[model samples]
Target: MSKIKITQVRSTIKRSKRQKATITALGLGKINRSKEVTATPQILGMVEKVKHLVRVEEL
Candidate 1:
């Protein structure tokens, strides 16, 4: 599977609990932190849920 980079671009303060959890699930909790992950459907769905909180790039 292809890999992608997920970066936390914004703060989670005042955000919904679900969004915060999704960010944590994606291996991120702080601004500018990044994780490289396989482009699985489940991962993509998580990313979609927190799309506004992160930046995704194909790798």
Candidate 2:
């Protein structure tokens, strides 16, 4: 299976509550923080939710 590297490229201060929570759920809170997660359906959904606040790379 493939994996994904999710990085917080921007802040979520003024974003929606769900978007902020999504960043935290991905193990990121501040800009430049990153986490490696499995490319599961659940993670994919979360990524989609906050796609604008993060940068993703295949791993």
Q: Which candidate number maximizes lDDT?
A: 1
How many residue pairs clash per model?
A: 0, 0
Instruction: Assess candidate 1 and give its TM-score to the true structure.
Output: 0.97
- How much lDDT does each candidate structure score? 0.95, 0.93
* Model 2 misplaced regions, further than 4 Å: none
Q: State which candidate has the highest TM-score.
A: 1
Reference-based TM-score of each model: 0.97, 0.95
Error of 2 at 4 (Å): 0.6
Tens-digit lDDT track for model 1 on 1-59? 99999999999999999998889889899999999999999999999999988999998
The alpha-carbon deviation from the true structure for residue 27 of candidate 1, after best TM-score superposition, in angstroms, is 0.6
Q: lDDT per residue, candidate 2, 21-53, as tens digits? A: 888888999999989999999999999999988
**Candidate 1: regions farther than 4 A off:** none
